[model samples]
Each structure stands twice: as structure tokens, then as C-alpha cells.
Target: MISAQLPILQVLLPLLAAPLCAILRGRALPHALSVGTVLLSLLVTVGLLIRVESTGTISYAIGGWPPPIGIEYRVDQLSVIVLLIIQGVAAAVLVGGGASIVREIEATRAPLFYALFLLNLTGLTGMVLTGDLFNLFVFLEISSLSTYVLVALGTDRRALLAAYQYLVIGTVGATFYVIGVGLLYMMTGTLNMADLADRVAGVEESTTIRTAFAFMIIGIGVKLGMMPVHFWLPNAYARAPSVVSAFLAATSTKVAVYIMLRVVFEIFGVPMFLATHLSEIIIGLGILAMVVASVTAIFQDDVKRLLAYSSLAQIGYILFAFGLATEPGVTASVLHLFNHGLMKGALFLALAAVALRAGRTRRTDLDGLGQAMPLTMLGFTLAGLSLIGVPGTVGFISKWYLLEAAFDRDGFIIAAIILGSSLLAILYVWPLVERAYFRKRDPALPPVEEAPLPMLIGIWLLVGANLLFGVWPDLATGLAERSALLLLGGAR
Candidate 1:
């Protein structure tokens, strides 16, 4: 019975566990429940991916009602790939976060934290799986609301401020998305994405449809932490708990990028998006974000904040790929989306270990950390190499494809921008390497030890995956190629 309902079960398992977590009192139970629930969801996701790969897309109608009216849960190669990333990251973070959560959150609030984490996971999974735009908005809010609370649960007082700022910014983005949806519904009289795609083609020349496109793009851009509107991200990631930072850094913006890809190439179609000169605008912004954000990361004193900026820069790379509006371009974007998730998840989890030992992640705090926490710092270095696009790292595979895409279009300048921005990554990452290895420890400080075994397990899992995928990228590239073809094929 559950096998027949895998699409809904994948999301429902986490959603159901969230409230149970809230009602439960014991910290251990809630943590265990949360981890168990996500692991279950991950198993379901794997099943779904296998099923989809063998049988093609899966569509489940809520309440036995058909689509174009009732809500639909859809699973395709594109969404299943994202589902794996979201669930994989969430499960790993929860498993590794036990020790850190004990130190970082109050005992009484711990269950609620786990509850919120599961809820956030539910929302993200729903957003990717849902086939209806209005349902997508509903899930988006579920995830956003949960994210706000999770951010506010941080030990730092500044967390409250960061959550409030994100609430304001995120609400505006959501509102913009809904308004766009309303316009599309107004024009097509349908909320189903597949139906809308069919209906949208007829109205492509309509000013209303064009306006809707603009609203949706900007809304997703805000969520994607695109340049200029990305102010909320650094503080949110910097001040949130380490687990929250790792999860959001890896999953949230990447989901937004997925929505953007769906809307632009799947719904709006590449020709329509390019017709408005939006592609050119996006390409320019992508370059600006890559250079500007990477340069800013170089100057940040806080290690998390630096990575936060680095995330923004990575988003720029994905955006640049999308702006190319070609099949290989989309393939590069999708590949980077997965690769960046692996790289950033490993980096942040490693930093979480450092925070567990040092109690903070400022640059000065990490000084001479190499000797004190050699394993943790080594994991950080391995992931950092990926961030710098070193060969035999996942980051290199993505950037190489990106460079090829740029060169294919006779965009030598774009290729140079990609190379130059990577150099900026070195500028920011080198300081950490130097501080951790080259600098001497402040003898006045107490001795620090390596991260707990569970934490080390989580960090190394991601780092190992990065290296493994870097050397053998066929799996990621194959899925990405399929996704790009599906999007460009207009199969929704």
C-alpha cells in the first residue's frame, strides 16, 4: 500500500513526524524521531527515483481527484534528483547534529527544534513534488515559516534580528510569487503546472503573462539569494545554529533555483524568457554576483559569513548557466546545483564541528585550529578545495561544464569571468587554510579536541562524496542531462 503511495508518503512521513515531535517532551525521542523520519523519507525518495527512472514520471492525485482540478503530486527525474539532495542533507545533518544541538539549544526547546526541522524538510519536499502552482506556494510558506523559527532558535541574540529580517524579505518574496500565480490563474483559469504550461503558450504575447513572468522571476531570485537582493542571507546563515546553517545553505536556495528552472524553461519556455531580454539581464547579474560576492567573501571576518557570501557567488554561477538558455547550459546549472550542495554541506558541517569545540566561528577563533582539531580542519580543507574548483573535486566538474557552455556560445568573456571569480574563491579560502595550518595557537586558550565521532562521520560522508563524484561524475551528469532535456522538451 505504501509502495503505491510513495509520492505522498515521501513528504507525509516528515510532515506527520513534525507534530509528533512538537507533542513529545523528551529530547532524545524527538531527535531520534526526527532522524528516523528523515531517513525513512530518504528511503522513500530512493525508491521513487528508481521507480521514476524505470517507469518515467509518477503522478498521484490527492483524494482520487484528477489533475487540472485536484492537487497533484508529481515525480520526475528532475524533482527526484532534488528530493534526494534535500532528504540526504537533512538526514545527515540531523544525525550529526545531536551533540551540537545539546550544547546550542535549551533542553525544553530541543523537541520543538527537531519538529521545525522536519517541517522545513516537508515544505522543501512538497515544493519540489507538487504539480500545482498554488500548492507550491502553500508548501513554500510552510518551509519559510519553519525556517524563520529555526533561525530564531539560535543561541546568539542576533539570531532574533536575523530571523526578523528574513521574515520581512521572505514574506515579500512569497507575496510576489503568489501574485504571479494569481495572474497566471487569471489568464489560464488553471493552477496546475502542466495545464498552465499548455495555457501559457497561447498567452505568451499577452502583457499580463509577461508581467507574471517578471514577478515570478524576481520572487525566485530573492529566494535564490541573487545579487543586490541577497542581503538577508549572510546574517541568516551566520547567526543560525550550525545544523540549520548547513541545511539551509545546501537546500533552500537550490530549491529556489529549481523553481526558477521550472518556470523559465518549463513554463515560460526559453524563447519567451529570452524574448524579453531577461536572459541578458540575468547573465550580467550572474557575472556581477560571482565577482562581487566572491570579493566580499574575501573581506569577511566571520568564517560562516564568508561561506554565506560564497554561497551567493555559487548561485551566481548557476544563474549564469541558466542565462545561456541552451541545453548544455541547463545541464551545467543542474550539475552545479548538486555539486554545490555536496561541497557546501561538507564545509558547513565541518565548521559545525569547529563551532562545537571553539563555541564560535570567527576567523580569529579558528586560528591554529589545525593542530587542535586536525580531522575537522582536514575535512574543511578537502571541502574548501572543492569550493575553489580544484581538480578531482566536484566543484571542478561543474565549473568545467560551465566553461564549456560559455565557450560553446562564443562567450569567451563569460568563460574568463568564470575563471576569474574562481580565483576570488582562492582569496577567501586561502586565509582559512593559513589561519588553520600556518598560524600558531594562542597558548592562553584552553586546549580543543576533534569533533565527536558522529559529527566527523557526517562531515566525511559529504567530503568523500564530493571527491567520489568529482572523479566519476557520470551519475550526476546523466541525471542533469535528462533534466535539461525534460525541461527543454516541455514535459513539465
Candidate 2:
């Protein structure tokens, strides 16, 4: 018999350990405990994924009550994929953070920093695992509040401003989400996602339900860093501590995309909404985001900001897949969600290492860096290759699927737009690669070694993962099929 307790244990192990890390009150103790807890959580997430894939959707009701009346934690292919992303990436970030965090944070406050990181991980894991919409909001806020504090811990005073800016915007997003939930509750009288899906389909004509959908989409779009609403990401990423940047890049916005997927495919049901041109609207905005953000990235001198813009453009591709509203498209979207997380996380962490060695992340700072820190720059190049959808990289797998999806629907214009966006990616990434390797600089400075071992190893693992998945695309593609089938209410 499959045990429902495992899901709760998966989330609670790290969550309950968070307070102990704070209470232990020392750098060594807390870091060790935090890493242990995250490792344990990762194991649990893997076990849960295996269980779900072998069996089917697993639902664990709180207090043994049924859903829609009592709270529930549901694990399906979609939830399992998200949980794996959160825990697996969190483990990697924590491993990498060991040295980077020590370098960046004050020794006295290291314990608190780790404690907050665990809290943020707990919140994100919870968000992915929960079946209730209201509970999703609770976890969303938990992650958001902790993230604000984490971003503010950067050495730059501008980090404080970035944190505050994110706070204002995050609060607004959360408030809109809450209002949307309230509207859904008023009409359907339930918040469980499965039950809500059934009810929402019946009431598609209800203005309140439609308004709820609109509110929730807009709220999540803001959080997901959708175009015209992504002002908070670049500064927040640029100013945050390196460890924070790595962690946020790996996990935060990915969770936001998860919430959007939940809202769109699970709750709204694509068939009901596709006729309304919701998919077309999402694709238009996505194309705009892809083109505009890539161009913006090309102009950025700050490496972090350049990457932040690149991240926005990457999100545009994922959004474009969603807009296609086909099984292949949705599958591509889900696959990219995982692929981009690994790619960007590796890229940003490499930047953190560059910052550590050179003390700056500007394009000029990276000049002649490929020779000074060959390993670090190699990692950066691999990640950049992934971003541009080079064959044998995870990025290529997603784009390939996206192209196939576009062609499936005779969407030549959309296919062209996708390819054009990739060309833009090359424009932004190539300059840095050029500056690092091909460009000449003064020959007098002492050659720097590669990033510290933990950072180097952690980044390489992700790069390796990117390539492994790229060369063998079935790992994510197969899971994406399961996720798509689940989201489409077993239509496959």
C-alpha cells in the first residue's frame, strides 16, 4: 500500500527543521542541519515521484477527511515534477551556497540566513504539493516573504531597495491572487483544485468565475515576470547576494510558473478557454516578451542584469508553448520549465563565482576571464549554449518540441517567431563569450584559479544534467506527457 504520510513528510521534514536551525544558533550547526534536511527532503521527493509514476495520483487528506471540505495534498505527475524540481534544485543550491554564502554573509548571521533559506524551500515545496487553492496562496506568501528578506541580505544597499520594490509588487500580486480565490470561493463554494475544476467548467459563463480566472492569471503573470510586468526581477537579481541569486534563479519564478500551470490547464481547462483566444493572447505577449527582452539583454553591460533579461525571454518561450494550448505544446512548456531552471540556475551560479573571483559582474569584468578562470567560464559557455538551444543541451529539447508543436498546427508564423527569438538569445550570449575568450586584455594581472570546489562542482552537475537531458530527451519529454495527460483530465 502506498503511504500518504510520505508526502507530508516530504514537506515537513525541512519545514520543521527550519526552526531548529535557527535555535541551534551557530554557523556550523545550522549549515550542516540545513543541508541534511534538504538532502533528506530530496530523497523523499524522489521517492514520491517514483511512487506517483508507478501508481497514479496520490491524495492525502488532512485529518483523513475528503477534499473540498478538508485540506488535501495531491501528488500527480505535474506535482511530482514540480516537487522534484524544487527539492532537487534546492539541494544543489544549498551545496553551492556553503562556500559562497560564507564569503558573502556575515559570520554571525549565517545561521539566520540558512534558516530563512529552509523556510523558503519549505514554502515552495508546499505550494507545489498542496491541492487547495487557498493553501497555495499561503505557501506563496510564505515563499515571497522569505525571498524578500533573502534578497535584502545582499551587500549592496540597493538590495534593500530591490527587496522593497519586490515586496510592493509581490504584495500586490498576492492580494490579487487572494481576491481571485475569494471570487472562486463565492461562486463554487470550494477551493480544492480537482473539485474546483469540475465546478469551474460548469460555470464558465459566470462573470465571477471569468473574473476570478482573469485576476488569478494577471496576479500570477506579475509574479512569473511576464512582459510589461517584469521590472522587479533584474534589479532584485543584480543586487542580491550570489547565493541568493543562485537560489532564486533556480527555484522562485519556476514555482510561479507552476501555479500558473495549475490555474490554466487544471482549473480553466484549455478547450473551454481556447475558443476565447486566451492562448493567442498569451502567445502574443510571449512573443513580445521574447523579442523585446532579448534585445534588452543584448544592451545590458551588467552580466547579472543581462542574464535577468535573458531569463525573462526564456519565460516567454515557456509562455508561448502554453499559448499553443496543444498537448505537445503543453508538454514542451513543462519540459522547458525544468530545463530552464537547470540552465539559468547553472548560469547564475557561475556568475556568482565570477563575481567572487573578480568582484564584479560587468561585461568588462569578464574580459580575458576564460583564461583566468577557465572552469567557471566553461560552465558559463555551456549554460549559454543551452540558452541558445544548441543541440545536445536541454534548451534544444524544449525548442525542438516547440517547433514540432507549431508545425503541428500549421503555425508557421509562430514557429518563425520562436526561431527568431532564439537568434536574439545568441546575440545576447555571444558577446559575453566573446569578451571572455576571444577579446584581448592587459596581460599583467595575476591569473585567477577557478571558483571554489563546491561552486564549481555544483554548477557542473547542472551543466551535466543539461547535456544529459539534451542528448537523451526522453527523461523530461516522457514526464511531460504524463503531466500533460494529467492536466488535461486524462484526455490522452
Candidate 3:
């Protein structure tokens, strides 16, 4: 029975716990409930992943209704991998964020905050698990709405403005997505993804289908922070509560990428997508994002803002890989998705520790932090190296696959661009390293200490993951290879 209900339980557990969190009276209770809920979901996701690996895809229909009519929850190689990342990161953030939240958020609002956090988790998990296009939009809104509130919960007044900006842009993106879904539904008379995939193949040459594809990509691109549509990300991350920043940085955009992958390969069919100029256009925009966003990150004064821009650049790398449309290319993209989550989650959690002790994460404020908060800064450094794609880091593994994919395509220029982009990451990361290690401490500032043990544990958990996955990448690489094969095979 437990094995049979894993799909619904993965989503329902969090959905039920969220309301319980809201009704809970105290900070500790809500925090425990939220963390427990996320951890439980994580365990379920692990079970689902193992089951999928051993037994193939698991599909559970709602109300015993069949496909093309009743809603379905499907677990496959791709969905399970994404589910593990999402829940794993959420659990870590909640655990590590406890002390920081006490300092940054009002005590009275803590329950509400945790409630919203769980709701966000529910939406993200549902978005990946559901096999219906309309249900995807519903889950997307649930997540997006909760995220907007959580972003606004920060102490900074600017958080409100940041949340507002994200709300406007996010709504527009969702609207565009639904319009596309509506178009597809009208053309095919069904919203089930598998059914749509079958139906869409027959209308591959229709102008309506092509137009729907355009709308869907642009819509999802905004959510994924694709360059030119990424203006809302920097401020949102920089201003939101640190935990919220870490959670969003780690999981949200990756879900958008998963949706894009589903739409591209499962619904639209890769052959049709690649046949037009769309692939080239996506690749060009991705390259532009890699170069332009990295350059922009180098000049940012706020550390969170800098990391936010860096994320935009990293998204470019994933898009660049996906644009290649080959087995190796998709593998690199999927691998990077998991690796980036580890790197960014550690970085943001470390920064949260910094904010708790050092007040702010501006470059100037972080000067000489290596002496006062060595462990936190050390974790930051390790994650930074991963960002730079240094040897023995998870970042290197992804870049290695990406470079191989580029070479496989015989695109020497694209490979050069990949190498050049890593240099830009070093350029931006080095100044922070120097400030932490070499700059003199200000005598007037209060004496500071390392982050609390709980926070340090969270930071190092991900830091250790970075090193473990980096040194022995077979786990991530093998899973990615299987996922890529599944996607490519399905596309045909």
C-alpha cells in the first residue's frame, strides 16, 4: 500500500502539513513540523527514485480514472531526480534556516512563514509530479504565490517591492503559459501530457501548434530566468529572507527547466523543435546570458545579488546544453541541475550564516570574515570553487560533460565559450576570497563568532556533498545518463 501510494503521498504529505503549520501556535512547533514534513517527503522521493530505477515508471491515476481524462501522477527517471533535489534542498534549508529565521523574522509570523514554505514545497513537487498540463499551471501558481509572500516576509522593506516585482513578472509568465496550454487543449481536446504528446505529433505542422510552442517557451523562460527576461531575479534574491533566497536559488528555477524539458521533448517533440530556427535562437540567447550575466555579476556590491546574477549565467549553461539536443548534451544539462543545487544551496546558507553574525553580505561588510567566521567562510569558499569548476568539485563534472558535448557537436567555438565563462566566474569569485582572507578587520566592529552549530552542519552537509559528488561522480553521472537516454528516446 505504501509503495502504491508513493506518488500522491509525496505531494499530499506537504500539502497537509502546511495547514497544520499555519494553525500551530509557536515557532518551534511549526519549524519542526515543516522540517519533518520536508524530510518525510525527501524519504518518499528516495523510495520513488529507487522504485522507478528498478521497476520503470510509476503512474497513479486519481479516482481510478484512466488517462486523457482523470489526473495522473507519474514518476520517471527525470521526475524522480528532480523530486529528490527539490525535497532534499528544502529539508536542508529549513534545518539550517532556523536560527537565522529567529533573528530575521518576527516571532509572531514564524508559523505563517513555515506554512508558506511548505506550501511552496507542495506546489513545486506537484508541478514536477503531475502529468496534466492544466494541473502543472495550478501547481505553478500555488508555488509562485507562496514564494511571493515568503519573499515579502523579510525584514527589509525593499523585500516588499522585490516581492511585488516578482509577482508581476511571474503572473505574466504564468498567464503566457496558460494561454499556450489553452491553445494546445483547444487543438488536441485533451490536457493530459502523454495524450497531448500523442495528439501533438499529428498536428506537428500546424501553425497553431507552432504558435503555442513560442508562447510556452517564452513563458517558461521568464520563470527560468533566461537572460533578457531575468531582471526580476537579482533584487528578489538579494532582498528576500536568506532562507527564502537559498530555497528559491536551489530548487525553483530548476523546476522551470524540468517543465521546459517536458514541453520540448515530451509534448512538442524534439525533432520538430530542432527543425526550425528555435534551437539556434535558444543557443544564441544562452551564450549571451553566460557572457553578459557573468560580467554583470562581477560588478555587483551585494553578495546575494552577485550570486543571483551568477545563477542566471549558470542557467545559460543548462540552456546551452539542452540546445545541443544530443544525448550527452541533455546529460550535461541534467547533471548541472543537480550540481548547481548543491553549490548554490551551500553558498546561500553560508551567506545566511554571515548575515546572522556579520549583519550583511556586501563585499565591504564581509572583509576579514575569514578570521571571525572561518567555518562559514570556508564553506563559502568550497562552494565558490565548485562555481569556478575547479577540479574535484561537482561543478567540474558538469562542465566536463558539457565540454564533451560541445566537442561532440564539433562546435569548437561553443567549447571555447564554455571555458571563457568559467574564467568570468573566477573573476567575480576572487574578489570575495581576497576580501575575506586578506583585508584587515575594522577595530570598531563588534567581536563576531562562527555561525551556530546547526547552521554549520547544514552548510557542511551540502559542502560535503559538493566534494563527494565531485570526487566520485558515478552516482550523479549515471542517473543523468539514464535520464538523458529516457528523454531522448521518448523524443523520438
Candidate 4:
């Protein structure tokens, strides 16, 4: 039955569509195929989430082979929620991304571009679905490779350099990750996550295991763009085509965070993670990222770069909450993960609209855009408010849960720091409004109307979710609570 096959079908839909996209003859067909693929994948993902809620975790083995021997695809409360985030964002960006894509990417390369996007989706989804650590590495590379190519496809010449930088660093990260996986396999003799979880208990004290743990964290942290290792993100987002910027910003690092969660809590066990005081180090890094990245963002002239740096600060929030690992803390972390995706997706898609009409995305380039493109700028403003954690927005809801978690732990300084860091968001966020609404339009700039309808739909869809979840957050909160419990229970 279709219900029983949801796990594989969720992955296979995008996987099959990717190759078809590469060979498609024309722009419309490939774009439609990409949109349809992601839409179908989203539905499958939704079904998978519902089934998991009703029946608990679902594990599907490949080739009728049992888990620990055959490759397995597992869906649980945590993975299913993450799957929803991935497919949901992917669908929104693709369905509404056509105008931006046509503007930036050459018509000749359209099919391949769609191909890479679907491949990227396949890999990210697979990374969430797979039950083997080594399999995760494989999926990680698939997504990373596709992402590097997609970054290179930007109309801006700097995009190639940005892609190269990410390639060099991403390759290093992947190497570190694979080495860690190899060490884990050597010690436990199994790559299956469930089996390794059982086997790792006996060897938790081994020096090799400890070293492997460190390697994994460093590797995943680089992919996560956590503070010092984030050299590639700003330029990459700044130079890449607006749609690529939107998609990767919204989904890529979020998936890496999910992978980190699975490895840290489910595979390695939280007690071991906490015993090393790595949790403290993580919280410290989060705090530093919050203050430092927000400050750095305030200086950026390019809109995408500004948001990219802001993303690091947001990542810091997620990291800080994750390190707390209490039910409330983890709940906040999970909620913020999804909420942040909506925020970034809306912002970047709006950037695409800016580039389409204004010829660029610099702060100065946006003068009088509020009048020329009222809908797009207003949507951007709403998403920016979410980023700043304004009341009645998803961003505010995330911060509310985060503050509650910090108070539960009696960490007033952490709570103060969280609130103070959001104030920094205002510094960067306000200028966008100021430039759009207050300044006179430059005489030389061409007269322009609103962005194409498809693109506007994409931008506003995410903005609507920002408000919808902000005002009615029961669904996101319920999922986050279940995922938080699953993570905490798995750690124990």
C-alpha cells in the first residue's frame, strides 16, 4: 500500500525527478517537473509525519534485509518533523521561484539547475531519513556537491569563487566527517545507527571513541557555519542567485543541525556529551555567535550578506537551546529550527524580487523600493520583523520558548543575552525599512512594477506562515514537544 511505502517514496520521488529534469528539453517542462516533484515529496512527507504520530516510529529496511544488516530508513517524531521542514521549504521555494531563476540562470542551463536542486533535496531528505551513519555521509556529499554547483550557477562572477571556497572547506568538512564515521565503524563494527547506539555503550570510555566524537562535532560544526568556520556563508549567499540563496539558507544548515542532534543525542548519548563539558563549550560558542554575528551583520551593505550573518546569530540561538537539552530547551530549539526556515526563505525570496526590479540587493540599491514594489518590500518587512522576534510572529514565539527554557534552568544571564542579542537584530533589520520607505527614489533607476506573480506567491507564502505560526503555533509547538521528548529519551 502507498501508506506502507511512504518512507522510500518520499526520497524516491525527488531522486527520480532529478535525472528527468536534467534531460528535459525546455524551461517550462523542467520547472514544472521540479515543482511537481517537490510538491509530491511534501505530501509524502506529510503523510509520513501523520503516520509517525499515529503509530510511533516507522523503520523500513532495504531489500527485505533486517536492520543492522541492510540499509534502513527510519521515521520518528524528530526525523519526521525535520522532514516536514525540508519538504515544506523545498516546495515553497520551487513552486514560487521561477521568476528569480529565469532572471539569474541562463536558459541553456535551466534543466541542469533544476536537476541539481532536486538532487540537493534528495540528499537532504535522505540524510534525515537514513538509519546508517556512513549512509548519512553519502547523502551529505550528494547535497554538498549539488549546492556547490548551484552556487556556481549564479549570474554574478563572484559566485564561482564562492563556490570554490565552499568546495575546499566543504570537502575538508566531509573528510573529517567520514574519518569520524570510519572510526565509529571500526569500534562498533556496524554503520547502522540503531545498532551502533547499542554497541557504543560498551565502548563509550575508549579513547578512539572520544576522538571520533570530537571529529564528528568539528565536521558537523563547519557545515553548521558555527562562528569561526563560517567564512564561506556570507559571500556564498551574497553572490549566489537569489533563489539558491533562499533555498540553501532556509534548508541546508538546518539539516546539518538535525544531523548533529541525531549524532550527539541518539548515537553518542547526552551523558557522554555532557561529561566532557562540550555542552558548556557549545553554549559559550552560541553566546559568542549571538553577540558577534549580529554585530557583524549590522555592517554589511549587501542584503543577502546581512541576512547571512544574521543566520549565524540565529544558529547560535538554536545551539544554545540545544545545549540545554531539557524538554523546554530542546522544544525551543526544534521550534526555532522550523521558524527560522520560514524567516530566511521569505527574506531571500523577497531579495530575488529586489534583484529582478532594482538591478541589485545593496542597502543603497533599495531606495524608494517601498513605493515601487510595495508588496515585496512590505513582505520583506514582515519577515524582518519575524527575524527580530517581534510579537505575534513566529520569531517571537521561538524566543518566548527559549526564554522560558533559560528561566527553567535558572540561567538569567543566558536569558538576558538572548533578549539583548535580538536587539542587535533590530539594528540590521531597521535599515532595510529605512532605505525602502524613507529615501527618495534614484532618478536613474529604471521604473519597475512588482515581481512576477509566482515569485510573489513564494515570498508571501513564507510570510503568511510566519504570521500563521506566530499567531497559531499549536501545530509547530506540538511537533517540537514530541521531538524534544524523543531526543531526550533517546539520550537516556
Each candidate's lDDT (Cα)?
0.92, 0.87, 0.92, 0.91
Error of 2 at 107 (Å): 1.3
> Could you tell me the lDDT of residue 403 within candidate 1?
95
TM-score, candidate number 3: 0.99
Per-prediction TM-score: 0.99, 0.97, 0.99, 0.99
Instruction: Name the lDDT value of residue 55 in candidate 1.
Output: 92
Model 2 lDDT tens row, 1-492:
435588889878878998888787667889899989988998888888788878888889988888779999998888877777778778877887687788788988888898899999989999999999999999999899999999999988999999999999999999999999999999989999889888887788888988888899889998999997899999999899987887787788888988998888888888756866878889888888889999999999899989999889989988988888888888888888999998988898898888888878889889888988889899899999999999989988889998988898898998999899899999989989999998765567545567888888888878888899899977678888888877765521
Off by over 4 Å in 1: none
Alpha-carbon deviation at 291 in model 3, angstroms: 0.5
Query: Candidate 2: RMSD over Cα atoms?
Result: 1.7
Better of 2 and 4 by TM-score: 4
> Model 4, residue 398: displacement in angstroms?
0.4
Better of 2 and 3 by TM-score: 3
Candidate 3 total steric clashes: 0
Estimate the lDDT of model 4.
0.91
**Residue 96 of model 3, lDDT score:** 89
Q: Sort by lDDT, best first: what order?
A: 3, 1, 4, 2
